[model samples]
Target: MAGMMRRSLDAFCITFWITVFLAAISSATPIEPRSNAIQELWSSVRTLVFPPTNRCKVYPGDPEWPSDDVWMKLNKATDNRLLVKPQPQASVCYSGPFYNAEKCAEITPVWGSSYTHIHDPIEMMSPVAQGMTCLPPNVFDSHNCSRGGFPMYVINATEPKHVQLGVDFARKTGVRLVVKNTGHDFLGKSGGKDSLSIWTHHFKQIDYIEKFEDKKLGYSGPAFKAGVGVQAFEIYKAAHEKGRTVVGGEGETVGIFGGYIQGGGHSPLTSLYGTGADQVLSFDVVTADGKFVTANSTSHPDLFWAMRGGGGSTFGVATSVTVKAHPEMTTTASRFSFTSKDIGNETFWAGVRTYVDYFIPNADAGTYAYFLLLPNVATGIFTFSMSPFFAPNKTLEQTQTLLQPWFTRLNDLGITFDPNITQFDSYYEAWRSSFPLEVVEKINATTGSRMFPRANFETEAKREELYQNLRKSSENNRVQVHFNIKAVDPANADNAVNPAWRPNILFAQQAVRWPVNATAAQILKIRQDFQTGDMQRWRDISPGAGSYLAEADRLEPNFGQAFWGTKYARLLRLKTKWDPQDVFFATTSVGSERWKVESVDGLPNENGKLCRVR
Candidate 1:
């Protein structure tokens, strides 16, 4: 079985790249030469970088579609594992092409949940990716699923060689390339138009190294090597069974070592330890040049630093990551909330403002809280912010004592509340109880966020201004605002993560959800408003502060300053050195500003091409 699997995987990659190479050669276009030394020199560079080919891509409806012989050869190469499944847009939508309205209606109710979407390897839970270009904006509109915003083909990559093949094929053939692990990206980075995607969902492997040591970094500890397909829950479970714990996301389905850690992941453990990127020991990756290399503090050190927090799909395809593991500890868990009976009530705002003010102190006390503020228009009251927090190495009584001040402030303001606090003997237990509640179904929403430093919570005047602006913007736009309170100090472990994370006590996020029937202009306006209006308060309150790129505003102005801060310039230079021909491009990545997705009538069309700005 092992030999068969190996041969099948090998054949799949070999056949796929061979077909791409043949396609490129068949599609070559004749160019008129300028007949000058300078032009010829430049032409040589261009040809070396982007080899011209006529048969590179077999687009739908193209005359050069693969013949039966070609299909049989490719199938034999892959041991009949190559997949040609089109986008399943219609499977869950009433407007989808294959299903009747009645049957589609039946599927919609069950499929509308976030769990259902995340379970599928390809479907993006949010309608944004689904409706970006092809599917009708209206979820209920009857239409056939179109491959407008999705990849034209996908290779089910189960090994590093498959990834290398996809990367080399894309570079050599001049076709767009994307990597998908769990398809849980917030910005739809996993999808691209007329692109070839390498799906690493099948690459599930976990190995633990006892007394793992890196001689160059002068460190030694226990570490777990997680494959690209591994999720947070899997690692947490495996680590726990081995008498250890790992730093990971709150979501159960989130890919741990994939894009999460690459974007400088934060967690309840961040306050006590450091950012997720700080736990990295080594990474096994396939570079753009089709070489599989192990990057660590000693080898390919620059690539190691960049991949830690620089953002995904910009450098190369990561196959596995070995991260630090900490000893397991007990935790105190609590969930708190207070709802106002009257909307815009002065007393409610004052009390909530006081709670917000305590964010810094809470983190300093080794508590991590995931909180959200919601205004209840129907009840004419605020559905006060909710916080599910966990304190490590703290008893139930100590945890309650730490939280008593905030409760007193709420009581002083005559606020009502029902708080659920509990104690767990282990970190894993505390996580399983509350983290599941964090799951969200995909919606038509766009987020804008900021990292609020200690200064924002230090002064009373600043606190008042921050809360007032937050309330105004959130209430005015009917947006939901959230905060992740974590006091992170990386202990001088240098990497490409935004410098703003080091001093920040609160990570603030605001999201605007649009109506399904809204016009393109309205949607665009909402997107624009998120940057200028909705996020204005965050920008004003935290000037020079950056955001977490994994979930920040997509249309962020001066994005380099907002996402990477002073690190952007260095990241750009490294990007050129690693991928000089720009083999990979994801929206809002390190060097994405140089390209634009094709748009028509002031809105992006799914069928339009992604062209270089120059």
Candidate 2:
């Protein structure tokens, strides 16, 4: 029986390989390079230019899928694939994962037309064909910024074969491939000039679950595995529905494996369980060569270690993540606010700062809060925007006592607030409202997650300097800079996801929304505003501080220092090895064309050749 089982598995893998190869070629039909003399040059820009979407396509049948025809299967899938309506002309060609196929191709000639219709690649397709262009005017602006660059058809993938096919082609073709989980990267990594984008949004599959009683990780966790598209909020909700719970982000739309986990996911529950990465049990990924592989403590240990917090550049396409689960417990969430009168008073701001410094670290490791700072320039009124959440179940009084110091200080400033607290039926219920799981599904036709961990969340001394600077800048009108820090727990030591993000423990976000395409005057106004109020506020801590990838602003230079922070070097080394040829790249990637491009550990470059460590 064992021999037979092995044979069966081997046969399925072989068949899967053959099918993907055929599908990859067939899908190129609609967008094959013209029989022009520029075929060679065009190939270099293959992923960048859309292959004319006019040609015959084909595919073969496989037993597992039952209908091994590539072109045919994809045609069938498109009909079933959900296409969101009410799309605007500007938005369809200039934004995120387009919900349809044809439009996706028109915008991303290389990835869309060439890679689309390929059975395995587009099976989980999440095409975002509509968005801004490289042309001019407001053409480059996206929702909050002025550039998402040229759109890349994110070939949303799910099954290992799907990822395997896309990556294999990238390695063979030398086409610049931009990989995206949820198109949520603030750095605009998932798309770039003449880039072929592969989307992992459609990679939503939950294969296994472990009850806390079983402890599949051997005392390390109440662990289970899921696809890359399984979001933090979705995981929380799923666990809650099953009467279980896990710690993760507090947002509704954040993807679990996209940027948040890649950086280090955090939430109110982190105080108790730790960051989402800390809880991973193992990870299964499809490498650049089309191999379906696993990374865990016992297998591919070094790669496993690196994936947790090293960042995404070192590894290939990761499809699913296995995470640790904890016992579900009760919890409390509370909200408090302050008015303009209290905010305008410097003494009040100082008192609030003093209390926050004292209370933040003193709050039980399980308790967490982030003050949302907003300034109403029209009134010269500043108000305290605070959002707090915690779990392991606490009463209103208990939660209030932890927050009382700051609460009282606000009253001293003429700020008073009513506390809102409710007992959640389960952690998932709380998770749903807090994180909004379905938001990912709503925002884009597809979904995925990412992580961005920073060594320094922030210090109270830093906060004081920030407010002081802002006070002076207030006279100049530049206080729109967003600064924030939220507490996070460590990831489970045994998680089996990508190896790049294993060491992160906290998450931070900072944003400056001036103008999408601020004119020279507008740009100057924003800069002047920050120079006085925003920039000076946090300038003291600026040297070592990092910014969030998703809340990207173009002004920052050497993004590696400002975003990846401490672990930048490790990511570089891994990137050097995996992408020795720099095949998978974009303007915002860790190892950009400008990087030294050295061999790993100072080894001599193998001249485009690399050895597999895992």
Candidate 3:
């Protein structure tokens, strides 16, 4: 009787809860489709199963399309800063009622301006927008380029809350998320079709700390916090005013906190200090879970390590970054140029090898040369142009003394060249005059890079092989070589930059371009020339060395090993932990191997869905 009484109590408890649940469900507005058995069963437990919020995202032409209610809610989330992508330039070119030559001519100078402009709607820096079928139209074509490869909507994010809102929206609703700041992405990562973009260009917050404290790293120093929209020139100006400088990019308009530093930023000061990623102290970011937090040595340390050099738009959206700063210093600037017409190809390359041989000594003496090695100027002429070199904390006399050997060697080889050297009062002035606005031009080229170690210049045979391979590749094309020997010890800092950069003296790159009217077959050949054909030449030289993913081939084999070296595994693990659902995706980035972009009509484009591979 006692056991029966206990069983009756248990049954009574269950029945009581069921009656209460049913009463609650009946009182509340019922979910439709109660006629279905499964729906009825789920309705009873809907309160516990689903949250009281809408997580549905509608595609174009869907039954529940983007209705007015949807737009109203999205606009409220971002405080009415949401925007629909437009094509004002397309209207100026071929979409107007009648073509306006005056407007078209007016926009030519500004064509390249949109590449770095934070507010530009264009997806590509190049005039010929790749991966688009209608873009780069012919002069006689009737139609203009539409928003084929650009984002469907953009949130002009100005604060951490804005980023969090966008992240939450994209996460709750299964939509692709991309970040755009200045639109300076080399791999076209700033744009994606049928996606929602977080335009962080308005998140411009800069702060300086004279005595920084980090209990995790156990060090403190002078540092600056630059927002996501902070460009190179802006940071330089601010640092100069503070009587200090920071390691950054050469492009004046490139965002300092975006893919530049995330991809192991190299600079003229690399030999003296280190790469930009090395100087980072912390980052304030919004993760895939829609939480804004700080990542540093002590807080979210794994995210900090991965974010330093693991490439951007893969883990989360960065709101701002704090990096170390250095005191201002004077520098000796030199500009030199010579032609192969003065010396034939065989002798010219021999002279080139001799010049390259001095990279170690120059780097040791605190000199970094920003030069270009062009094998062909026209029909049979090659050019070696070191437009402006930096000799930090050196006087005019010391600068000339350092360059005297190079001059003497050129004189001995009968190579007539102009050596234009000067001294600057500050590094800012030197960088300003040396690396100008890059002379904006309409270019449609993809590039592949290789980091050549200092050992390549040690032996005559190695140098000969390097020069021979470069000459053969540039026989009918152009390959530009940048010689900046990074002699700093990366072991001092823990980050994810390519290991190959630690022992490299030069960064060599080869690129190919195609016309707007080029056939699909021709475009494929151009891409293959860089990814497979030209890359093999450099691979033969540095079999173990890796390339910079910021300017590397998209078709690179074993890209994880090439980009991250031994850190690939750790990075992949952290990527999974941080973004298990793949909220962020950039081509060739970590964990991107799991997804493959859709191909359209035998051509690859972002319009199609990014389907999972495995």
* Per-residue error (Å), model 2, residue 574: 1.9
- Per-residue CA lDDT of candidate 2, range 1-614, in tens? 99999999979876665565445444432222233322332233232211212120110121221121322332233332312121222344444553344554454443323132222221212122212322111334334322223322334454555555456445444334556665444434454322345567666666446543324345444555667766655677677665667655665544677556655555566556555666666778665545667876677665665566544533666777777767676666665666557445565456545553543343343665545445566777766555644444666566667667656765675656775765665666554554322211111111111222232225655556544544544344433322122333343354322222322222323333344444435544554454344443443444454544444333345657654666667677776765554555533346653532122223111111122222
RMSD of each: 10.1, 13.4, 8.6
The Cα local distance difference test for each model comes to: 0.71, 0.46, 0.72
Better-scoring candidate (lDDT), 2 or 3: 3
Q: Against the hidden true structure, what lDDT does model 3 obtain? A: 0.72
Candidate 3 lDDT score at position 303: 95
**For candidate 1, which ten residues in a row score worst on lDDT?**
40-49
**Per-model tally of clashing residue pairs:** 13, 81, 0
lDDT against true structure, model 2: 0.46
Give a tens-digit lDDT track for model 3, residues 1-614: 99999999979876665565455445532323323432333342323211112232234554434444454466665667787754535345665564567766666455456443455644555322225533323332326655555777888888787787677666544566778887665566776666688888777788989989886665678899999889888899999999999998777888888878887888888888778888899999988776778999989999999998999998889999999989888888888777777577777776776687677778777677888877653577778778677887787889999889978887888877767778888888888888746422234466677888877877878877877777776774756757566747544778888888888887787766667567667776777766667778788788888888876656667889888889999999999999977878877899989876664433334554555674
TM-score of candidate 2 versus the correct structure, residues matched by position: 0.65
lDDT of 1 by residue, 1-614 (tens): 99999999979876765665556434432123323432332232233223333323333344444334443333333334345545554543434345466655554556554555554545554446434443322444525465556776677777675676567656654667778777666667777766777777777899988999987666688999989789888899999999899888777888878888888988788888777888899999988776788999989999999998898899989999999999888898877666666434777778878787688778888778877777655666666646577787678899889889988887777776767788888888888887643343345677778898888878889888778877886566455645546646645778887888888888877777778668879988887876777687679878889888777655778888888899999999999999876888887898987776664435432234566775
